[model samples]
Target chain A: MAKVSKEELLHIANLADLNIKEDEIDNYLKNLQDILNFANIVNNANTDGLGETIGENDQCNVFRKDEVKEFKDNELLLANAKEQERNMFKIPKVIQ
Target chain B: MDITNLTVHELQEKLAKQELTSEEIVQAYVNRINAKEKDVKAFVTTLCDEALKEAKEIDEKRKNGEKLSSLAGIPIGIKDNMCTKGVKTTCSSRMLENFVAPYNATVVEKLNEENLIDLGKLNMDEFAMGASTEYSYFKKTCNPWNLKTVPGGSSGGSAAAVAANLVPWALGSDTGGSIRQPSSFCGVVGLKPTYGLVSRYGLVAFASSLDQIGPITKDVRDSAMLLNIIAGHDERDTTSYNMQKKDYTKTLNGNVKGLKIGIPKEYFGEGINEEVKAKLEEAIETYKKLGAEVEEFSLDIAQYALATYYIIACAEASSNLGRFDGIRYGYRTENYTNLKELYKNSRSEGFGPEVKRRIILGTYVLSSGYYDAYYKKAQQVRTLVKKEFDKAFEKYDVLLTPTSPTVAFEMGTRSENPLEMYLADICTVSVNIAGLPGISIPCGVNGDNMPIGMQLIGNKFEEEKILNAAYTFEQEYKFREKYQPEFKG
Candidate 1:
């Protein structure tokens, strides 16, 4: 098995858009190592020429007919929103 | 009947006959919850006033001689992962503690149409990761059997609620053993219907492909009644099957005579507690007496199921949980100088220990360099696991196994060790990986006197067959009459 170095953990966390604290890097590395050890067991199984099982059973199109439908209560729809700005959901600005 | 101990069938009968009012039933359960929920910590949010209001409407409808749905006037507990409109839908994580759902889950919506009473949103593991439900950011839910033991989780609160008789039945999401293990621990019937049998449009995503909403009830028939209402195709859920709905009660009358039940040998050996194994063997003998045949089968791929499930479930969770940033109506920390720090600080402080652990593990497995070796390999092994079941089901009508290897351990037993808790799901992960329907029915009590569940696995979209087998066994075993806990409150 290839070694998962400290630099690799940071790189993966970046890809996942997760910001891990500097001190918790060691703990994450150790946890990652244990998980890898467990995943290694699956490596021993023979899965040659097998298709991946992505979703459960099968995925079929469940669509509705295009037509006008009665709308739900707008007030009820907006009741759970923390910030309702002009009938729209508002969120903190995302950094570029 | 004590409101907690009465099954949905009995409750509905009383309401239909005007012997009891829906409002009266709702008040009874709410009053019962008032006396007990403080020590149990099973509810994250209780719809006390809302439930009473809906119950009054249901009773008024009945008085007007209007048709009522099967679940009408029944009180059902919901897992925190399932969205209840206008109610807090925290997945027992600090990240979404203040988050309330704008819309209801399809199951919840259907139950609402029937004017069923909503008791509350039950507790769960943070982001539905851990097995003991101890990883929840909120206070852990204590098992009703013994306050010290854990109610096996992700859906621990749902199972604990039903078992403790807090409600007649509950809706829970099972990704792997979440519903079944806790049901086994709490001594109730928990079913994980064939993937896509029930809609997942509004269930908070843990692992989209692995999750299915099903009922945890006091008996097999109650499970059937709940499934009859919730099982159907929904246009909003792409994975839901476009299959015709059936009256599940019809299948219970079908005899299990000449039915072949496959007993996978992989589940019986190693790690399985001796008491659980003995009870399983005894149940098999009982099946033979009832004219059913039990035979041995092999699922070599099952040994790798847990490994595959964690990789795939975590990979999906890593992606699904991306929607919970400080923005989008969850927790927000304004103490940060920049937008990036705001997102980071909020999630870092908001999520619990278990959710963070899974995110890190999932991110690593699905990372570019290791994706093929870990995630891809697990997916391939998953096919092998499903192939094993398909090969077995060709001859056998259903498969049986121990729902959980050991009985419920003490509350603080595996809290510190995450891997040990993960292993408790070894028997259950294969069913989820295969995407087949499964049910965990209480077979008997172990030497320790805690309930033990025997599982049944059926072919895809064959929830009725699984329910038939459980109902048949329930009638013969009389497991419903064996309530061990004190539910007086």
Candidate 2:
């Protein structure tokens, strides 16, 4: 069975960019570990000759001719933005 | 006449004959929703005024002698995951609670083209994650069959809306049995087309590889008619299959003679309730009497499908949902001093517990050290599962299995156990894993009088075959009449 520590849970949560609460960590850890333990059964299967299936269809590299289609709806696109500046989404400063 | 009780085809004929105007039909459905919405909790938003206006427009066009499509004047309940311009398309999540889509989804565009009136946005699991609507950040949708039980989700409201007669038909998305399981629970017809058969453009992404929008309706013919409108190639969706568009309704001849059907032994094993099994047995007997050859088959690799599905689905979800980090168009944290805190707090506050759990698990599996062990291994196993289905289809034209292991459990019965909730998808997920078409039609009712559904799974792009087979059983059985809910309206 897979055992996940609180620190590991926090680290994974950090990687996922989620701010898990201190009280919720134990529950997340138990559930994540149980799911992982169940997922570990894949190791028992014989995959020596198998190829990974990223998608199900036979068609790949689908493309269309390069053509410009004007959206003409920037106001609508930015309608849901919490904060906007000059019709662009405004976010907190990232640079130090 | 109670117009809301009519199927899409029946309503279409009535509208075509000018016996009923689209305006009157819309009014009837609106009245039904007003009467039963409190009990069913099926809609996240109801477009009553807009639907009536659109219905009047259809009537106006008919007066001008304009051609009408099959879906003209039909009221469709769209699952909230699909984008609808000028409509609040909350994926039943707090993150998108206030988000109004700027554009319509591909299917929504097609429905609009066909002049189908949008009844409103139906409720679903938060971003299509859970097997029950209990995970919805919005109101819980109860089964119309029994208000005490869950309407199986993440398309629970879509199924419930149809079953409760709030809408004649609805659109739903299935990643891993999201459409089929709920349709089973609600005693309706739902189809999850082959992965690329229908375009996924504008669907709020949960697992891109597995998600496909499908039709949920009162009967098989309606399922086919809706599929006819939605199934096709799209330039926006890269994964959309480049195949000839099929008239799915044309294939429903109610003929299943000499068809080879396989009953997977693995699906009938442990965890299935006895009553559900009995119902499945009776369905098999019906198939046998329809001149279809039935035999027991084994899909040994299906045991690993659920585990692989979670790993792959969650991993893709972790990546796909990364776009919702409070910057672009979703929920933003109110108080954040820095950018890092902004992303963390917004995501943390925006997502529910189940979404957080899946994101964390996905992050772990796709992380550096575990990539090969979990994510890569799961992909290889997915290939194996697909190969098994391909081999089975070589001999059998279609496969039959129970849509869900059991009937709808009580609202809170399995909510606390996430593993138990995931196991409820055992009978249906492999079809998605293999990229096959599957339809769930109500076959019988269990001891509690809840509906039991039998799933018809077809090989890739074989929706025609499955629809015909389901139509045969639907004609022979008329299962809906046996289990119709007594709506008080």
lDDT digits (tens) for residues B1-489 of candidate 1: 576678888887776677888888888888878888876788888888888888888878878988877568778899998888788888998888877777888998888877777889999988888888898888888888777888899899999888877888999889988989999988899999988889998899999989988999999999998898899988788888888898888879747899899888989999999999998899999889998988997777656999999899988888888776676567777667666676677777778767877877888888777889989899889889888888998999999999999888998888877778889999999999988889999889887678888999999888888899998888988886865654322
The TM-scores, one per candidate, come to 0.95, 0.99
Using Cα atoms, each model's DockQ against the true complex is 0.54, 0.83
lDDT of 1 at B122: 92
Interface Cα RMSD, each model: 2.3, 0.9
Candidate 2 lDDT over residue span A1-96, tens digit each: 557889888888898889877787778877888888888988888888999999877777988899999998789889898999998999888896
**B1-489 in candidate 2: lDDT tens per residue?**
778889999998987788899999999999998899999999999999999999998888888988888558878899999999999999999999999998999999999999899999999999999999999998999898889899999999999999999999999999999999999999999999999989999899999999999999999999999999999999899999988888888888888889999999988888889999998999999999999999998887656999999999999999999998888788999989998899999999999989988998898999988999999999999989998898999999999999999998889998887888998898888888899999999999977789999999999999999999999999999987666875322
State how far residue B216 of model 2 sits from its true place (Å): 0.1
lDDT score, candidate 2, position B25: 93
